[model samples]
Target: MSRRDIVTAIPTSFHADGSLDIEGSRAIFRYVAQSGNEGAFVLGTTGEFPAIDEDEFRALVAAALEDLGGRMRVIVHVGRSSAFEAVRRVEIARELGAREFAALTPYYLASAEGAVESYFEAVSEAVGDGSLFVYVYPKRSGIEVSPALLARLAKLPNVIGAKISEMSLDDIAAYRSVVDDDFVLYTGADRDLVAAGEVGAQGVVSGVSSVLPKPFRALAAAADSGDSETIASAQAAVDDVVRIIGGDMPRMKAALRSMGVADGRSRMALVEPDDEALAEIDRVIAAYR
Candidate 1:
């Protein structure tokens, strides 16, 4: 596997009453920077972007850039259900000096290939000189960003890369085949980091890394060095951590709280982990620590 960058898809911080916790979010960004990961992908799926309003979104973006902009790269996710709204987000981040941005395909209503292409065309234009990453999460967006579509989008000068989610290694390889060698690809699958690298993905935008970064960092190192023993160990650790968290917003926040990072509440309606599950999550964190 080639050297792979690990960018954490950090969660948003919210108080129990479902309000944005700007300070807590700043602390979370600070923690990601201190953890030695390559960068932070903020206001992403893990951050619960859909639930956050415009004001809350702006505050989160400002807080993340303020905290991590100088220390590391910060990819702001400006994906929204409408092209106009997505462009507005791009403008907001650009004003804050954000250079890299990712936007998912328009969600909720089904979008045809033409509409999707137009949407990205508008967003790429808005990004102008800044870098734009096409975020393809078909499961949530209900839109498939086919390799063919991506090939066309790649023609846009600033449409530099993509962060692919819920797709197979073969699917990613297909994506790689259609684009130029310099076109970057980052897998959203935390467990397949090494395999994705093998298939030409340059990195992973990992939600799991937001909480347990050590194992992911260790895995990246092991892959780079071809250390089979360490790779196996790190991969096992990552799988276990993902299983414990299970992509639950509440559970991830709970794990963050266990690490003394931030509050364990979500604006989205989600069930808090039971005591037994929470105990297991703590054990998982401690083992990695």
Candidate 2:
């Protein structure tokens, strides 16, 4: 645990023509590696994963592994709503030196009673990577991974952890009751990091941490040491920054741009923020900077 558990859900950098910005992506990876983050979860929601092509995904994976130089962990999000495609990305990422992998239940299909478990077993067993963290994102995947399912998956030798997106602390407590202390849990929601730490979340797979890695690490440190005042202060700062970015992915891009880290262009489907939102993001980023 400690700060070694902080995982940044790093955003994929993109150019204006909607292509992969390899160096920009490298900048993100470099930032995390230097800022004390222990892991990078690429190609997740903030990365606009659904909008990128397979070739671009491959490039990003290579960039992460190469840049990190084994200094930190890189967990690639290989889920594609198709087991075959997800497995394909896992194979590709493994070929590029990605050691850890993560995935979610099929997004567009109705998984059978045991289909979810079967799908993950197939992928993890196929890749045979060091560890696998199943992503629990009901909103995007449209599939729910019940606590029973999670408990079962915890038994899988290679299935070491999970990236829980929206579970409340109570839900996390329920998961703890089922799985062992060795089963690591990461909160995908930054706003809940402090409470999650109190409820046994080992780390965070945070989108905001891509911009504010230092404070995120501080929050984890305080939580680890039971410093309630520091946790409250750290969470307030993160919440202020999150509110400024709101739900706009592009604002996250702009936040990075404020730090001179990215071009701020996502995929073709995503656009930059409006003048109002852009101004707000800059103002808040200035405060953090």
Candidate 3:
């Protein structure tokens, strides 16, 4: 894989009782590796980050590192609204042998550009060593991290780059324009994978790809090969998968279950797929297959 490539935001597999499934960590990693892409972003929104507790959080990252430690680059998301929690999570991941890390813009309180920058600055300072990827998700974070802020933060020795989850091509381009050509700007939205790549996005951090990594993996190949047609077709296929799976992770787990991978379960109170949704998920598997 090129440095500019795809890395999935893998789902945190859980058992029926809503506990962290350690074995499932290796299971998910094997699936991603077989899909032809290396690297992953664990415990992001797709992994139900805020929903899972600290102990559960630590166990999952430990499991991912133990499973994919030497084989693939694992960048774990260690950001919550609380700066203290983010610091604690980073410390734990680093200790577990997690090599790279990423963080969402802080939530539940102030999310202004400066406030969010301050939150990441503190996180980088907390780590005080390794580089970190700042996750830019305005919808959940409740604030947009502007390109200017990203550029400023990227100047920090520990702030390597960012994972821009938003979908503005101009915004992504703006980020690329400021940072070094090699600066990592990972795309979070799968629909814009090709376009974002065109704008110099270095890699992808996708949620939908977790259920089925093959298509996104292929899309990444097309992007790397500069095959526009294949990229478009793969994007269309992923959009179809997204349409079937929707944003509901329980439904994504359902689709993964159909593929004989994940166990098709989620945390407490997460809505399961309705009959129509299940049927659509089945359609996605069969069509994609």
Candidate 4:
């Protein structure tokens, strides 16, 4: 398997007042490293990279490396509006000992496939390393990266794989059918873990992993081991909690609170899940457990 295997998405750690809690963030990295899972992902959607500044990003990388103690591979997301800034971050991140990089297409406005390709190429050249993976989340970024475009970009010596969040199952299968099997294929949607795995997804970067790492790990293992029943049970467990939390970061945040991990406060502009949402999430988690 490639080094970029199943990676758990990082969670946005916040204080009661909804400020970045570096200590809490470090604790999360440590927890995932020791959770019997492969490793943890940083600066992905759940990490709220869009809201964090460069300093916070550096701090996150530094703290995760310290807490992880080199036990797991660190895949840092470097997507940003300014290509220069993204490239600079990747260079510094490598110096910090991050082995892999994942970056999404630039946001704010959609661009042509050629522009997206050029943007990623610039990042790869700036880092002077071809060991990076592209993050594809058209649903959130307003950029639809066609499989043809991905196939074209994959030609880059450093671009290794693509992490897709939205697409029909048939589209995913079709993309997989066309791409080199050795190229990594990951799903950003956590609830589709089983189906994704079954359809030849090499790994997943799931928001659920921040709070329910064990369950996600179990589900992946079940799928990998061909244990359909186990996969079903685990998927049901994930679906249960996701339904209460509203099935995204909000739900994942509430799950952390239910498990007494994160403080249940998202950064400003993104507050804690409402009381009803939290109560419903708790009820569902309790039933599942």
Candidate 5:
């Protein structure tokens, strides 16, 4: 992958009962691959990494690798609160043939800049030659990656980039101005992919891609072809549709289910979106189409 390909995070498909639906997950993976996206990230935020067990994670990666069969680049997000666990996941991802890896700053209990550096170092040491990108999403993990910290970490032999999940357009531009060319700056927010791209985001790390791969891939292709109009159209379509679902994750799952892709029931602890919510989402998508 030329680092220009849009990289989408794959969500683990779950059955109605909330069990890992490996087959469903594979189907979704195939869907994304066929959509012409450059690559997909397995076991990341949208994959419900925290709720999934170690065995499930292994199985999910193995299944995706088998299905992808080198058709698309596979980037694994091996971040966990525990550095050891993150390293272990990195090893598993490597064993499954994943060449790209991303690790978020550990969540909760803010780590001193040194501790954050140490965590990436431990993961880097474990995953040897695989390309690595720092995953920075402070809202979920109270830790942020400073430009200075990112610059220091980018010097690590195998660390190639930082996945900027929270940086606004100006912030992204500021970081881009300071970072070296070899260091990638992948945008984390799906909704801001176009803005990110305009400011030189290498690619997108999107949760919305789990369901709407076609649109996301379209935006990516536009960026590659230098076609701003097409990018705007695709991004607008997604933003308009996602409006009805808004911040309700359950509704997002329900919306996908309504389209015939089962993403397992929104895991326990989340209230499933009711029929009314689904109708609103349907209406939003229908209006745009």
Candidate 6:
């Protein structure tokens, strides 16, 4: 069986007034590592990267590397609307000894044809010899990365792999068909780890795994061993986690708070769960325990 990686898309902790919570962030890093995840995909969608300012971004990168640098692989997301800014983040992470980086296609603007390739080219150049993964999330990036585009980017020496988020297994299979055998693929859809693996994806960059990782780890294990019963059971647990979080950062933070991992505050305009929702979240967490 092939190796399977479960890298958690962790959240950036913030105080009530929206200050960076360094210790809280470190605690999350420790929690994920202790839970047996292979890596941490820091400062991605789940980390609220778009809302984070320059200094906050640096602090998060430093904190993550400090906490988990040697213990596990830390794939820092340095994606920005500006390739220059993304390059700057990549330089910062490199200065701090980060070896793995991921960059999203430039967003919030209508780029001409080939702009996405150019953006990745700039970031990959900045990365030098370090590994870089193309982050393809069309729903948020306002751009679609076709498999052909990925094929072109894959030619870049440092462009080693990609994280395909909010996409279908068919999409993954399409991507798998384009890239070479060594080029890695990871799905952002948390519930489809086993299926994605079956389709040639080596891993997952799962947001749901940040708050609840055991099921994800179990699912990866089952995938590795090709254990049908365990895969079904672990997938069910992951589904329950997805249902509880409902793909909302506020609820994810709420679950983390209940788990005593991090506080439930966000810089984004996300609404926290109210009475009924909070009660359900708590009940579900209790049942999981």
Clashing pairs in 1: none
> Model-by-model lDDT, in order?
0.90, 0.79, 0.78, 0.74, 0.75, 0.86
4 versus 6: better lDDT goes to: 6
The better candidate by lDDT, 1 or 4, is 1
lDDT of model 1 at residue 266?
Answer: 87
Global lDDT for candidate 6? 0.86
**What residue pairs are clashing in model 6?**
none
Q: Write the per-residue lDDT of candidate 3 for residues 1-289, one digit (tens) a residue.
A: 4455667778778888887776765587677656555677888888889887888888888877776666677888898887888999998888877758888878877656777777887899876667799888887778677778888888876888788876588889998988987688888877666777778887777777777766776766776777778778877887887677745788877877888886747875778889988898888888775
Candidate 6: tens digits of C-alpha lDDT, residues 173-255: 99999999899999998888778888989988888778777777777777666778877887888788788775588887888
Residues 1-289 of candidate 2 have per-residue lDDT tens digits of 4433777777778787776788888887887778777778888887788887889888888888888756778888888888888889988888888778888778877676488888888787866846888888887777888889999988876888888887678877787778888788988877777777668777778887778766677677777777778778877887887687644577778888878887757774656788998788787777775
TM-score of each: 0.97, 0.92, 0.90, 0.89, 0.89, 0.96
lDDT of 5 at 47: 75
Candidate 5, position 76, lDDT = 82
For candidate 1, the clash count comes to: 0
Question: lDDT by residue for model 5 over 1-289, one digit each (tens)?
Answer: 2345567677677877878788778877776677566778877777778888889989988888887756888888889998999999989888888878888889988689999999988998987888888888888899987778888888876888888875688877877777797578888777766677667677777766656566665655665666768767877876865566543556656666667765555554677766787788777646542
What is the Cα-based lDDT of residue 196 in candidate 1?
94
lDDT of 3 at 169: 80
What are the runs in model 2 whose C-alpha is more than 4 Å off?
1-4
Instruction: Give the distance in Å from residue 280's predicted Cα in candidate 3 to where it truly belongs.
Output: 1.9
What is the TM-score (0 to 1) of candidate 3? 0.90
Query: Where does candidate 4 have its weakest 10-residue lDDT segment?
Result: 1-10
Native-referenced Cα lDDT, model 1: 0.90
Best by TM-score: 1
Best by lDDT: 1
